[model samples]
Target: MEPRLTNPAGLLPDVGQAVNILYKSAHTAGVPGSVLELVHLRASQINGCGPCVDHGARAMRKAGETDDRLFAVAVWRETPYFTEPERAALALAEYATRLADRPDAVPDAIWDEAAKHFSEKELAAIVLWIATTNFFNRLNVTTRQQAPANY
Candidate 1:
């Protein structure tokens, strides 16, 4: 799709930089970058935002993620491709992204499951990444940001 805006975030010069700082801050926290990529891909897939999904997959591939794992991200619950930690993270991403689906979004069960795998700091980072990916998904979908090329 053609972009609806040349530089939607550019209207405010510091927007991109601000987002970058927050993203960088999250990266520096306890969660590994590789796992965060999976969270991003899963969340983007749920949002049906092509640009974020494309970018997330490319990020994973660049980090040496296998095709099997990459393809399994969307159906993580049914696949054997992920570890328990990854599954917990993906679950957190799903519930957080689709908050309106249930009355108690990010219910205690999912949060407790994630807590079983991650430290409080690590959980914070995963959550930040989830929130950030959702933000970008809405922005890209709203502005019709196209993927660099169809994959």
Candidate 2:
């Protein structure tokens, strides 16, 4: 479908400010670029947000991520292609973003596993990464923002 509005430029205020916050959050948490991309892609896959999935997947590849890892991300639990840290991040992503389906909160096992590969700051960043990606997924899906033709 075509866009509901050409830009919706007047709809929101401080759009630049919001983007700045997300950009700072991404860097401050020291979440690796590759890790952040994977988290975004995985969350977007679950949310079925085409823009996020396309953007994240393209970013991952641009950052030199292997096709095997990208392709297997959705089925990561059943594959041996991911490294220990990536696996932990994926698990944490699922647990955090799927909170509606898991009221008990992220389990200790998942945290422990992730903690093994991340510092406290890194873990905090990871959580923020997941949260931020979720926000973008919702925004894109609700707005029906189409993925870019080349994305």
Specify the highest-lDDT model's number: 1
In model 1, the Cα lDDT at residue 116 comes to 98
Task: Tell how far residue 22 is off in model 2, in angstroms.
Answer: 2.5
Residue pairs of candidate 2 with colliding backbone atoms: none
Query: What TM-score, to 2 decimals, does candidate 1 have?
Result: 0.94
In TM-score terms, candidate 2 sits at 0.88
Give a tens-digit lDDT track for model 1, residues 1-151.
6889864676778888989987997898878888899899999999999888988898889889999999989889898889999999999999999999989988999999999999998898899999999988998888888888645
Question: How many residue-pair clashes does candidate 2 contain?
Answer: 0
Candidate 2 lDDT (Cα, 0 to 1): 0.82
